[model samples]
Target: MIESCSGIYRIKNLSDNKFYIGSAKNLKLRWFDHRKLLRKNAHFNFHLQRAWNLHGESSFEFECIEFCEFEKLIEREQNYLDKYYHLNVLYNLNPTACSQAGMLHNQDTKLKISTALKGRVVTDEHRLALSISWHKSDKCKKQNEEARKKASLSKLGKKESIETRVKKSIAHTGKKQKPHTEETKRKISETKRNKKNVNLIKGDIYAEPS
Candidate 1:
């Protein structure tokens, strides 16, 4: 039986001495929630969840580090976080206490996520759903367009590596590209002409004494 109290808590992994620190109004309820989510592998903290999965429940110990008033819960938790901020043993995904927003994952966590997603497969239904969701949002479409433009600008005058060129060649080997429509051709020609005019104005392209 756990005591119900407002306090700062630590969930420590006995195996590695790594731990996650948090505070709650009711320590007992919070501990219960953590265990429930961890058992189901659905904890909001992915770092803690992964560690719990790697090292069984028996390897973890939960304890109330300090009993504080409800108002001071966050402050107390932040103190513990600051104390261990530089250490690599903390399993906390967020550097700050009280809120999990705006926290960037460490490189180790990023590599772990990359490795976990490396061979994951997305179903056609899932892919279609994602496409539909993106298409449904005007903001997403605008942002995507902006990203494409930025990427196009960044790639200008850049040479691809030999390996990249070979991979692209292989990928497009059997693909047939559709011919541009007359309207598209006209637009392309106009764009090129405008670029040439700009370059001539800037003295980038030499005009032959005309």
Candidate 2:
């Protein structure tokens, strides 16, 4: 009969006797959230998620550590965190016990968030925050295959300039190369001759290669 009350709570994994300390405005509601997330294998905290997966629901015990005013909740959570900071013993996931209640977003809201940040200039502090967020994200580890293919296709059929061609020729000047086959030579000559004939028929032939 845990009631909706502001307090510090601890989730004890009975399997390994590890503890995770947190505080919430409503003990009952927050406990329900933790149970739901763990059951779904979708908890935001990796350490807590792993524990839940390793040990099933029956192995967890939710206990009210102490009741506190809503304003002093985070402070009380931090005090509990400090007590368990030594020896890496506690399974507490937060580096600091400064957690806000989580929120859920649908796909449309996620898209809106992405659109809003489209052309914003990122400051160093923002970059650091992004680094922290992306440190454990799978998206940062690999490029999407479809995105890579789209990028490749975007550059397709782009013509190189004469300067670029000359620079490339200069770079490969001393490399060994294959001589053109007779068929290739004939095609090249025929192409040039057709261009010359076309220019001549127009009565302005000399400016082109003949």
Which predicted model would earn the best lDDT? 1
Give the Å shift of residue 201 in candidate 2. 70
Candidate models: Cα lDDT each: 0.79, 0.77
| lDDT agreement of model 2 with the native | 0.77
What is the per-residue lDDT of model 1 for residues 66-173, given as tens digits with 9 covering 90 to 100?
A: 999987776688789889968887987556665232346566656655775676676554455446545655778899899999999999999999999999999999
Identify the runs in model 2 with alpha carbons over 4 angstroms from their true place: 101-210
lDDT of 2 by residue, 1-210 (tens): 787999999999999888888999999999997887667655656677777878878999999989999877866887888788675768764435654765444566466556755786665544554455454346754556567888899989998899999999999999998999999999999999999989888876346767
lDDT, residue 112, model 2 = 52
Q: How many residue pairs clash in each candidate?
A: 0, 0
Q: Residue 194 deviation, candidate 2, in Å?
A: 66
